[model samples]
Target: MKKTKTRLAAIAAVALSAVLACGVLAGCASDKGEQKASEQPEQTAAASLEGKSLNIYCGAGMTKPFQEIADAFKAQTGCEMNITFANAAQIQTQINTTQEGDFFIAGSADELKPVSDYVATSTDLVKHIPVLVVPADNPKGIQTVSDLVKCDTLLLGDPESTPIGKIAVKAMTDAGVMEQVKQSGSITTSTTAPQIAEALAKGEGDAAIVWKENAGKDGLTILENSGMEGYVKTVPSAELTCAADADAVKAFSEFLQSETAKNIWTKFGYELV
Candidate 1:
């Protein structure tokens, strides 16, 4: 009878060990399930706007930085962006005619005036500064706004179509030399900043007033204190009334002011407001 009791005791011990082992395995499974559940919310949030798309009207000068921002936004939310780039006036006309864009990003706040009634909300993103750029080696010896009269050919943006053109006129006018600058040289009008930069790079013009960021192009030198101070324009991004997806537009609008977007703008030579 004692031998039989010893065997029974050994069996009972094995059974207890098996039960504890099973309990430990079950606890591990529970922990894993909780971890997976905790991660779901983040995944869901990242893909909340998946399969959605937005139409954006952007200024031509902002193409580089805004393109990178749009790519980053697409990666985070899996949404697609259709960007239309042109001079501010052209973009304003497109927005009014189409009546179908999610956001409007302009070189200046003034560009948004015609579309103000269509803008649901707006935010200032950066500074649009105009600077005088000349070809390398200062071929014309132009050193100041007053010296612009020396150039046989001077490129200026069209005040009716470009923010830089308006700012250039105002800067020269503010310094009391607009008429002389015009009379001393042939004032050639461009429709966009890149066009002015391109014209300068090819030696098509002696000097041009363009956005400060455009001065980064090759074969150009920005002249300091050429009388453009205090004529800075504010770059503004606005959500339009024609936004097809409000949530997606809101998400992108918020992203425009994020640190990531600011870094891109700075990388492209833009100054944050």
Candidate 2:
């Protein structure tokens, strides 16, 4: 009986040893695959929908060109992204009270700082704003600021709360005719900056104070004529508040004024500051 028990014990030990050997080999194979993966060159992660989401508060008109660029960022960066567009005043107001977004593109740098009211982190990124435009035909015979005001055409800009509207109102006031003109009922207000030109082109209004970039297109007369260019200033920032995704915001912000964006900007009649 003792001899028989020893033989059985030897068989059990060999089986256990064989199982341990197979487990060790399997672990080594997995480790090799992990090491190989780590050794490979890292891939650039362009902006992606499945990655991190970046919120942008900026001019709605920028949506098209911005998306075109963001599409490429996705192909490369793998970061998620989203944008919330609004007029200058609306954005500033929201930034002051509401939770801020990852980035802020102000029409003027002067307008961007309010983001700090809620969020402590912010950075100015780019600058741009409206330049007056008229019809290609120069209907009502508009030429310069003075001529623009004299005509029976509509003067365009956001309403009073908007920075550009305030600037435009102030400019017209400085030129000595803000109230007189408003009193005369000669002007009409639009929501977004782009609407200035759209209103003119669509014949909803006559002349408009549009962004320079929004001018230069077909069927529009650029009334951003020399010397009367004192209507506004441009400013923007990539950082604002406690942005949840700072990296992606910084990346896209850097591209806002990039040559590529500038080209599209100029195409729209906006001049670089």
Candidate 3:
């Protein structure tokens, strides 16, 4: 009976020990699983991009393209993003005045560079070209750059303060057509590229002069550019102010330079400079 009691006690002790060991193992496994799950998303984001703040100048027609990049970055980084679009020129003025947002994208390099210069990342974000836009029906039978200068033809463009207008005027002048339009009393003015297209759609003008990227679109035809002699360029840039995540901005900026971005620019009838 004593031996039996001793044997029974030994068996009980072994069972309790086994149970305790299982509990400890399970606890460790649970902790490891939680830790692994927590690290997975972070690792994925690091490999791709993080969500971040991306403010673009109002005139940035490439919003759709950029938006795609922002979305990707967000998924990769698990961060948040707030995007605000406004006139590139006005946006620049705002950035210069108040120093707002994480990045600034403009219709022209002038606007992008100014803000970028403040951040020392100017050249990394620029695409230059003469802005070209026209009516949807190819009104004035615009086949060449010279046709845009028809004496009786009306041309709508952004105000001189806007990059689209600035480049349009430069290209037309380089093509020896802008002065002719002025001589013919055909130049009209709007505040933005979309406005110029709107005017043309309304039959307010014989043709429209806007950013080259605005050309060949539904509202307009792409007549011509100033080229080497008369071509103007639109440059775009990015900023680094309060960047939500460095990778997000970097990936997005690179997206602007990607083939997809180039395709968008070309489809819009813009000359890639």
lDDT of each: 0.89, 0.64, 0.61
Angstrom error of the Cα, residue 57, model 2: value is: 0.8
TM-score of 3: 0.64
Q: How many pairs of residues collide in model 3?
A: 20
Model 3: per-residue lDDT, tens digit, 183-217? 77777777666667666766677766665444434
Superposed Cα deviation of residue 65, candidate 1 (Å): 1.2
The better-scoring model by lDDT among 2 and 3 is 2
Candidate 1: tens digits of C-alpha lDDT, residues 138-207: 8889888878778888899999998899988887887787898877757999888888899889989999
lDDT of 2 by residue, 121-155 (tens): 44443345556666677667766555545657575
lDDT, model 2? 0.64
Give lDDT: candidate 3, residue 23.
100
Which residue pairs show backbone clashes in model 1? none
Per-model TM-score, in order, reads 0.86, 0.72, 0.64
- Each model's number of backbone clashes? 0, 29, 20
